[model samples]
Target chain A: MIENELRPKVNEFEIQGTNFSDYQSPLFIAWQLNSICNLECLHCCEEAGEIMPNELNREEVMDFCQQIVDLNIPYVAISGGEPMMHPDFFKICEFFRSNGISLKVETNGLFINKEVAARFGKLGFRSVQISVDGASQDTFEKMRIKGNFKKVIEACKFLVEAGVNTEIVFVPTKFNIHETGKLIDMSYDMGIYGFYTGKIMQIGRAGQNWDILCPSAQEYEEFFKVLTEKEKQYAGKMKVYYYPYDVIEELKYRLEKPSASLLVIPNGKTKLIGPLPFVCGDLRKSKLSEIWNDYQKAWKKDEVISFTKQVIENPELLKEANKWREL
Target chain B: MEFQKHVKVRQEKFGAVVFETLREKIFVTNESGAQILSLLQAGKEPEAVTNELSSMYDGDPAVIKKDVDEVISTLQESGIIKN
Candidate 1:
């Protein structure tokens, strides 16, 4: 028998004079391999293209992957500016696969071709998330800005056909909120394993264009209700995971409690929360444990619970809750 | 957050080096550049530093002024330099 293949390493380190723990059990690591992307999406959080030649090089990424393997992290998501745009992307995947790490990749779906999808399937990646903001070419192209919507759909088809555990990530916006249900149906028709929705955060390009980017809380909740009903109708075939705000009380039973997750930027700077301001520390200089502990302290349980409750009860509070990272 | 236009030292695996944060981009510099940055941090204007740098390094004042101006513009764009 494979003796409990997943085991987390418990190590401590310090960051900016604060102590923390690293890679606690049940936690996931999000490694941002590069801040360079093939297509510059309209609402990119990283403002990716601005920073070229990100600090963490190929060797550094391999070493970091090895450390996660040593720690036996249950899962790790390779994200980007556009992870596929990384010169050593395949090598990184091969390293993770050899280490028995459950891997997930978040991509724009523009760069992924049939050959790449097949390779990912061969590597046994647990999941691949492709973002499709709109249902039709006109809507999708407007937001995605570069690639054709048909190309993205083609990529999705490739992943689904390749027997990959595929997810369609739809970002609800004023432009695409109305098409949420259609997008889900499209995802289902394409043989997608699941669909997940993300609420746009007001940061980076989105922040700059808040007038057009930020959707009202009511609009989001309405869309959520529609999607939830659709999910019920198509229950056995495909799974749908809503964003934090859209999740209802009844769905909470199915919702997994938020676990500790770490996001390391391309420069090796690590942050406990999702993309936002302030990094805990640079992983190369500080031990992972130290950064984790300091992050835990920052993430006050009482505060998070209270804020979460408020958001569920009053959708208007979603904006405030999304900024949990900054707090 | 707001950052001031100045040279900050970042220690990398290679060695301790200075980078001028112009907006968010980190631009590395040599000893002479560092000295000029220090002078700027000390509230010296480009014009004021021209004579001093010319006497110290035996370089042309016009060249020094041109270089300082270019760096300052980049720093301003990067949010490292404020009026």
Candidate 2:
């Protein structure tokens, strides 16, 4: 059904009255194929690398994909645990592509090899975002924990060579902030399309060791200045973006707000916002209009206001916001 | 009069409800409850809130007063609505 047909009609009593055009629905849907990943990063939000069995099965995922296609979402981002870890990762990609939904896979770049990269390219995937937290093995391995930096680099090469749009996301912590430039240069050399440098948000397991994971405002400013300067130097070659709410203003002009995006968790909970526990609505039961209406109401009631305000006030928080774009 | 901490009314698409995420609980209330919440946000006293609800809805002042008091008391016990 067309979104307009399903759009809820808001009347005067609506908390946010009718003139809510500025609010856009999610254009890209991020489906967490599985929460299990090969690498356990220090600041992993989805807590990937930890297997959560009893998640959505293949049939359920297919149904979810059909719903997404019905909704006419332009893009679907397959994330994890590690999407590759799912038994039907290839089938999932094929299903999404066959249904005319552009797929973007978020991975650690370990399982993605030359063959897999070529297959994804052949299947017409839109982009592949791989987290390369460090430029060197020492720092990269530290953040990714179980990830093989060499394998990640190899995956990058394969994806680039296969003509896949590759985006390298660097989650800067005290240990890897210094390697930001090197990471960018390395990613650019690998012929990647963009580099997203982000600060480690003190959420999830990363919150425990926040003293080391979270960067100070001053540190972020220095890192951002250096990175953006490099980004300018490499302008035509690759686009670079930064994260954390603090640096949004600096990168605001370059950000493109897509038309509609939605994130469906394994449990059938579809979220318009970030990967928070509060879902907009469950697609298994609620209609798209119901979800959109709920999201609008929540957004109006300041549920998302604090997070948006935090991003506005602190550019560093933009990093998380940027991550959502890829998701 | 004993007052509790701040109370916030989060109006979602399903309906206007009060919830505390930190506590991970939802407090469901009706339109009158939402009206009472609006008045409380303005720092209105129980009597004023009763008066406002009485005026807004087709209810008696005494009944409104008792209902508002009950809602406020429950909200207070739940640590959402405060004085």
Candidate 3:
């Protein structure tokens, strides 16, 4: 029998609308819990290691979570420099879980012990995605500077043993590209439920290391060929999801359709995703629903469209606009 | 006899989408299966579901009963229904 905890939250929204695409509410929130990270990885997108001064307080974070509950958002994906490092991480997770909001977490996995993994299982989180950048300890330590490869491996085991649905998130860099197949094998061996990997985005600390870390076009092609074969091999056994980065296609997609998910930073501000740096509204200053609607509408603005066009035509414009600038 | 608390059926034009919320599983049923599921969700007994389906469709009563029983058994196996 499928356990009660295995059921997904029935989205009334899916039934009410004739077409799923026509429905406008943000399907989920990518809430960055804190800026504090325990690792200083070579490709750290947020360069996250220390907490920002303006990080949201527990009360504010709880209020924002309550707002999400009120808005009836069924799912949330929490991440951070490392989300588990958040002072009120469990409290925030409990709020969402108790409200019947399904959750997925993106973490560095250094903090997950047996007790923590069991708690995650008991809370019934949808899945926990732990970053595992390399297949071997040497490459892992090289990419995830200051990260303990053995500790993370142990964490994955603990999560799996605790009955928590654990997954791996890999950012294919020069150091880890060759190990993609090996890592997937390792993840499957660990009893991971899914494997999510993608081309390392050239932003933040990664942008600084792009020349050295970014995989060559030929290397990416070779890696993807291996990935396709692995997908078939793991078809029924484990789920494999990857995002092959294409700058032009991604920019055009963003121009035509905004993300169906809101990106809430550690400071409670709803920022647009990378490339078109726009802050729609602050959750602390406005209702989440209002901010979400405004964000959707912001996609069609003349300035936003024009900026996106210029960037699409001349990708270098992205470098200047990538910072969190008010639109 | 009825859907478990976690099972939710959302009617679609073609049929219905049954969400087993706990395990996050989804079952897409055809029109007849949707009717059977809805009847079962409305607290109908297996025999009553067969009768209701028989009245609505042109299938033979005996075949309808067998189909209903099959659907019920499948739902039970999937943990969507409880006795």
Candidate 4:
């Protein structure tokens, strides 16, 4: 499950508390291991390339993971250029699982072979979201610039068959919005727990080709219309969920309180969700607990809050709100 | 009233976060609500709970009676309290 989705709407939400020990304990954290992904998606958010440097070495990452587990963080979503590319992927998974922290790995699905799937099943991950990108192999290949499309499909199937709670993530870009139904049907046929779809947030390569990559508001609405019908059709058989690009308006409500989750980049920078380039602190510079304690305060920082207010005012900012893009 | 099966409850200092896992619904309530929930979970009768809370908080009989009745009604409405 997306930690962002569990953020309470307002004070009225069922998730509330008082007399907290340490607000430093985040409900969840999404950490990017490194940005050296093999497949370069057209709308790559991290602008991930083949070359990755300045990443936390395995020892540093292990130390940080230990700190996170000690802080009693409930969930962690390990993503990357492709998290599976991390040299210590299995070690990291084992460490987190042993610490009683539920893990959810998000990857391009290229790395999950039968062996990887068996290890994941052994460790008992809460879930794993392997990006499908498109409904058909041709369309998937088109969006995901390089990769043997069959391998990714094989990887997903292997994970599911191995008893891993595998989730397929389909990113709806302009090129494949029409094939969303196929994507849902594909999930229904496979019969895993569910699948996730979300609108492409224009950034990096996506921002450069926003006109071609990003779907228009009308197009997304039409897509969701089809999705809603599909959801009804597969209500009992399969669960299909999508994050609409338009729902960032809810961020305004979210800003009233501390965020339920936080993101950590490969370089250990505490990052904001979506395309925003706001970094609160480098985890290497301070403890994860310290950074989390300051997370609510981080949102109040001038430029970030201004950008957020601007987002509240102009919701379209969400579609393409990268700091580098503005420059 | 007994809580439905899978109505998982966790008590906190201030109150509790009750999760009805089957429905995937969570309810956040204050300390008083937590007391009522604990009492209910222990299989206390409504009248007995009312008497206990009324004595504990030094509340008026009629006011406590009405208040307890309303709280039970609300919990019942939300399917938190089961027959």
B1-83 in candidate 1: lDDT tens per residue? Answer: 12252324332222222323111123433345555556666678777656667677655567666666765665566455564
Candidate 1 residue-wise lDDT at A95: 87
Interface Cα RMSD of candidate 3: 10.6
Report the TM-score of candidate 1, chain A only.
0.79
Model 2 / residue A157 / CA error / Å: 0.6
Clashes of each: 11, 29, 11, 0
A219-322 per-residue lDDT for model 3 (tens digits) = 99989998998999999899987866565567787666555678898888888765567788787788897887778777777878887788778766656533
Model 2 Cα lDDT, one tens digit per residue, B1-83: 33232222444443335533222244555455556666776788889877776676665577667777777777777776544
Q: Write the per-residue lDDT of candidate 1 for residues A105-180, one digit (tens) a residue.
A: 8999888899988988798777888989999998888788776799889999998888888988988788888899
Worst 10 residues of 4 chain B by lDDT: B17-26
Question: Each model's TM-score?
Answer: 0.65, 0.65, 0.79, 0.76
Residue A141, model 4: lDDT of: 89
Q: Which candidate model has the greater lDDT, 2 or 4? A: 4
Q: Against the hidden true structure, what lDDT does model 2 obtain?
A: 0.64
True interface contacts reproduced, per candidate: 0.00, 0.00, 0.00, 0.04
RMSD of 1: 22.9
Q: Per-residue lDDT tens digits of candidate 2, residues A1-327? A: 112322122112221112232323334466777777667788886655666656766677777777666655545678877888789888878887787665778888888888988997788666788988888999988877877989899998999889887888888888888888888888878898888866665445575566778777788888989887987989777888765453343223212221234567666666544423345677667766566566556544454555655655664453453133211
Q: Lowest summed-lDDT stretch of 10 residues in model 1 chain A?
A: A1-10
TM-score of chain B of 3: 0.91
